[model samples]
Target chain A: MSFINYAAREINVKIVYYGPGLCGKTTNLQYIYERSNPQQKGRLISLATETDRTLFFDFLPLDLGTVRGFKTRFHLYTVPGQVFYDASRKLILKGVDGVVFVADSQEARMDANVESLRNLEDNLRENGFELKAIPYVLQFNKRDLPTAVSVDEMYRLLNYKGEPTYEAIAPQGMGVFETLKAVAKQVLYELRRK
Target chain B: MDAGLVMYEEEFDRITSILNRLRVESSANIVFLVDKNGQQIAGAGEIDRVDTTSLASLTAGNVAATDGLAKLIGEKEFSILFHEGKKDNIHISIVGQRLILVVIFDERSSLGLVRLRVRKAAAEIERVLTQMEAKAKEVGAMEAASPFAEITDEDIDALFSE
Candidate 1:
């Protein structure tokens, strides 16, 4: 839910980077934090386990230039990729402005990716926002990995029709901003349309 | 408004610098400032990975609910909520009357440092925000001078059409 401040003349939107465990969800954020101008980005917060597994979520706030005169700020988030943290994941999706599904390209994690996408939809449904209603994008990550599945294979398995998707090697920063911009554009387009 | 309460570009930049300095000095992963209702005001660090928006909203919701529950039991609003899960621990503290400052850290960052850094940042943030809010309210008051101040019924629908 956005808090409209007529004073700042800016609209703030919250976008979440969600995916299965070890799918480079965190790495994507690390890459963004590394490359983004310090002035435009915020601290990356990760709630991970004692062993360093993400337990709750991670956060970063970013400013995506401007639309009209409004400085658009997006609050990015990643839910813990571990399967059992479904409750926490649901909590994170409440009132989300958009979603970036980071699907692992590894053939082995196919089930996890599908399951995670399904869970994303289920959670959205529970919040009264369906997969179609929410502005969402896809990132096929870990392209540098040798055992990574082909783009065609991943697409066939993790099918989300009509939404913009990207092929990313998130660690090396490939397709990071492209993905962010696409979704941000969609969000602003939605805002402008309103 | 207090003249000393301004958070201009220079002041805002200084605060961002302070956030990074503290994060690096403290070795914390995520640190952020959110309004009383869970809207993020400013933040620093590997922020793209976490969900600060929901964190802000949920943290506010959690605090409010707990406070409500506490009131029913004849207690004041809870000031902080520290949750230690199996892997991560969350330190949620109210910053002045305006916002909540949240810091999430792993074993790499020491608890004592996070506590110390957050304590110092909270005071400055409170002062900065108090001033910003006042300025914002002033601007809002001025906007009422517009003819569109009397927005029509169809305008509301058109505004949310997207």
Candidate 2:
């Protein structure tokens, strides 16, 4: 959800990065955190297990300077993508304003991608939100892999809403900003509509 | 539930004052208000030394996790949570089921004092929150004329123009 403070002249919005395990959800956030100006970003927090897998969520808060008169802040979160972490995933989606579904582009991971998308829809529903009603985008990550499936096929399987989709190699920072910009734009536009 | 929360000047002042009062009454090191979505609304007391934003986000996450535990145990919700540390303690409570009230105290203050003060502050905060909600609903009509309404694609693109 977005929080607008007239007294503070600030607008804070929440955006969630969601996908299956090893699909680069945390990597996407890490890239953004490394590239962001230190003055414009908060600490990158990850509630992870000893193995470094996200156990709960990864959080990054970014300040996008001023938009109009209000300082725009975006809080980015990534849910634990392991299937057994459904409860944690649902909790993370509670007040989400936008979603970035990072799908593994390899041909072998297509089923995992589809399952994760369905899980996302179900989790969002439990939070009283629908995929079609919220600002959402898809990122086909791991595009540099030799076995990466075509973007068209990934979309045909996963993009039921036909939301904007990006091809990314998150470890290399490819298409990272582009995906963020697209979802952030949609969120801002949605706020104006509201 | 509303998809957004807007804090007007009047309600902001009221909340800040309540937090400030609670800080003094409870002898707290700091007190801040956070929404369920982890946005820090207002803070008072010695806040400069702490990172309010990170604390706010983590506080919300903690509350949400507790809520999940409550559900599993066949409970509606746990309205309050307290964490006792060696030197510092944190008292977290939900106000109006929409906002979180957090009080950080050290050895100088007792839990009983903080709890009592929080109960009083929660009531006052609840009243102000009710008013703020109503005001937000009324402002919905004015949103059509908001600066955001006039924002163009170019303006959005310009944010990342660097």
Question: What are the per-model C-alpha RMSD values against the true structure?
Answer: 11.0, 1.1
Which 10 successive residues of model 2 chain B have the least lDDT summed?
B138-147
Candidate 2 yields a Cα-based lDDT of 0.92
- Evaluated with TM-score, which candidate comes out highest? 2
lDDT of 1 by residue, A115-164 (tens): 99999999888766778877889999888889899988888888687688
List, residue by residue over A64-128, the lDDT tens digit for candidate 2: 87788889999999999999999989999988999999999999989999999999999999899
* Top lDDT prediction, candidate number: 2
Candidate 2 stretches greater than 4 Å from native:
B142-146
What local lDDT score does residue B79 receive in model 1, on the 0 to 100 scale?
73
Q: Candidate 2 lDDT, tens digit per residue, B1-162?
A: 464788888899989999999999999999999998899999999899798889999999999999999999999999999999999999999999999999999999999999999999999999999988888777776665344777788888888887
Report every candidate's CA lDDT. Answer: 0.72, 0.92
lDDT value, residue A190 of candidate 2:
89
